[model samples]
Target: MKKKELIMIGLMIFSLFFGAGNLIFPPIIGKEAGTNMPITMIFFAVTAIIFPVLGIIAVAKSNGLKNLAGRVDSVFAIVFTVATYLAIGPALAMPRAGTVPFEIAIAPYLPEGSSVKTALFIYTTIFFGVVYWLSLNPNKLLDRISKITSPVFLILIFMLFLGTFIKPMGNYAQPSEIYSKNLGLQGFLDGYLTLDALAALNYGLVVVFVIKSKNIIEEGKITKTVITTGIFAGMMLFIVYMMLAHVGASSASMFPHTKNGAEILANTVRYSYGDFGGILLASIFTIACLNIGVGLTTSLSQYFNLLIKKVPYKIWATIWVIWSYILANMGLNKIMEYSVPVLLAIYPASLVLIMLALLDKWIKGNTIIYKAAVYPTVAVSIISTLDKIGISVPLLTVLAKKLPLHNADLGWISVTVVSFIVSFCIVHFSEENK
Candidate 1:
């Protein structure tokens, strides 16, 4: 591919993955991680940047996630694929994307006495309508996202970041207990919560299509190009995240303690530019969010068409638009409350799947490895999800708390490692004996 073509492709990948909710993470991490920001961000990058890139590489090398996942079992493949798509689609992400622009970016700018509920309904209708329209044709997603939405979103975000440099907010403050005590691990856990790796698998499919649209016919070449583009996308994420985190770190001394990255960003912007900052920030969020909504609607609709073959793509997109619009009207907080538990339940399994896909050559795609690693991780994640939603199992909660790195919400990691080792031993020994 030409340089210009590669840049456009990279931007498309970046936009597909960088949803507006992503804006809410880095700053909160910086705020808490404080003086230890470098170490924290390095760990954050390992999960957020590195693994997500690897996920794309895996999908590209395997030609698709379904084929890779099928190494576990066809039944598991179908179920996991559908669950992953839906979790990132209308069920959670789309609704959250529909609402987030307003909650984090736009709502602050609304005139007093305006009906927030009424405004949300109006906004999401247009948002999902555009999403549905864009998604109606998958071939054009790269054009709309990369050529139009991505550049606009990048410019607006860069404007916000630029102000932080032109005028510093304040010095980074001392970290809170968890961040100070367990900085790298906490940051590692924070990165996992981004859910980008799962999204990367889905977006990897889009990359394949985009490359084909350019007439790169060979699978190996497509895979190689995708890996290169993935690194480019990861670099973009690192730069953007580092800037956003720096903004948060700088604001810690000036602004009072804020609970989320969005609040931290808003306060910093308002301080720098007063009333007009709200408008600028709102545009950044609105564009970023709308890009993701369109990308998800397109990816999911196409997948459903392939999976079922009965329901058409447009129909699926319509269903998503309707569902997302309604759920979005329920507002951002409710959407996150429902979505977080589902993501918490699924994300560990996703990471395991990605890691295993990377190691498939070494293990020769052993079903035993996939089974051992993912099954227990899924179970632990489900219990963790239940605990998160306050439906606790007393003994399980105690066990989870005692696990290595559990304090960082990685209770499943220890269990997954042990399960994989034992399963590998059993599988290897049995084969040798036979």
Candidate 2:
């Protein structure tokens, strides 16, 4: 591909990764981080950008998530890959994307006594209709998304960032309680919660296929293209995150007690642009969410088609769009509330899998090592997630909480590391015996 095409592909990746949570996270982080914004954003980029970039590279290197997880075992490959797809697809992220714009941008303006559910139904029907159409033609994603939708989305975001500087909100407040101490770790943990890492593993196939369609057929060239595009996407995310975080920090004093990023943004935009600001913010959300909807639908459909060859891609797209549409209308907030525990359980395993994939060469791609690292990570995370949701295995939950970094929701990291070391040593001693 030419330089311009590469840039456009990068923008497509950006649009795919940039969604409702992406919009919501930075502002709250900025509100709390305040004076610590610089250090905080750097660490935030570690999980948010670096890990996700690595995930794309890892998946691309392994051909796909299933192949990467297959280093553990075939059963694990199928199970983990499917779970990751569903969690990031229609089950959670896709539905949330379909409804968030309606909640934040459209719902507030509904006529008094209007039926919110009815309005959501009409809006989502239109939303998913567009998503399904675009997703059915994944080959044209480059033209539709990278060339058109993504550029428009970027312009609107730039408008919001420019407004913040043209008319400043207020000075950043002192760091909030949670952010005052362990700022870097807090930033990493918060960024980790974005779920972009898992999305990267799934979206890597999308990026790879898009590049291959351009007739870049060599594996080495494909890997390099994907990595370059991944890094470019990460850079865009960093720039956008800084802009949003600045908006959040500058508005801290102005919008005191604002509970979430959506509220902060709505208040900031309205203050800066008045009634028209609502329209602008709404436009931003609609485009952002729509971009995500199409991206997820396309990627998920493509994967399902690959997994089950008898089913065509268009049929898979139709299935996901309908499923997501049904789920999107069943109360957006309820979907979000129920999704938390499931995502928490899967996230650590995703991270560990990515790490192992990246280190595959050095580790000699040992299945024992992969099993040691991944199994404990999932076990610890699931126990912890269950405990949080009040469904604890009493003994395991207690032991999990006592592990290092448990309070930070990262107890699994320590457990995975210990498991990996023991397994590596066992492999080495067996080799010595041989």
Stretches of model 1 off by over 4 angstroms after superposition: 392-401, 429-434
Which tens-of-lDDT digit does each residue in 1-434 have in candidate 1? Answer: 88778888888888887886689999888888888887899899988889888888888777777887788899988988888888888888888888888777777778899998888888888888888888888888877887898888878778888888787877888888998998987888788888898887776677787898999989889988888888888899898898888888888888756888989989988988888888888878877778788878877877778888999888988888888888878655776677778878888888898888887777788898888899889888888778778888879877776888765678898999999889888888888999
- Candidate 2: global Cα-lDDT? 0.90
Considering summed lDDT, which 10 consecutive residues are worst modelled in model 1?
A: 330-339
Could you estimate the TM-score for every candidate?
A: 0.94, 0.97
Query: What tens-digit string does per-residue lDDT give for candidate 2 at 1-434?
Result: 79998998889989998998999999889988998987899999999999988998898888888889899999988998898899889988889888888899889988899999899899999999999888889999989998888989899999998888888888998998778888989999889989999999888888888999999989899989988888899999999999899889989898988999999999999988888888998889989989888888888888889999999999999999999999987765677676778889998899999999888777888999999999999899999988888897968988998999998899998999999989989998998899
Best by lDDT: 2
RMSD of each: 2.0, 1.3
Q: Best TM-score goes to which candidate?
A: 2
lDDT agreement of model 1 with the native: 0.83
The Cα error of candidate 1 at residue 207, in Å, is 1.8
The reply for model 2, stretches above 4 Å from the true place, is: none
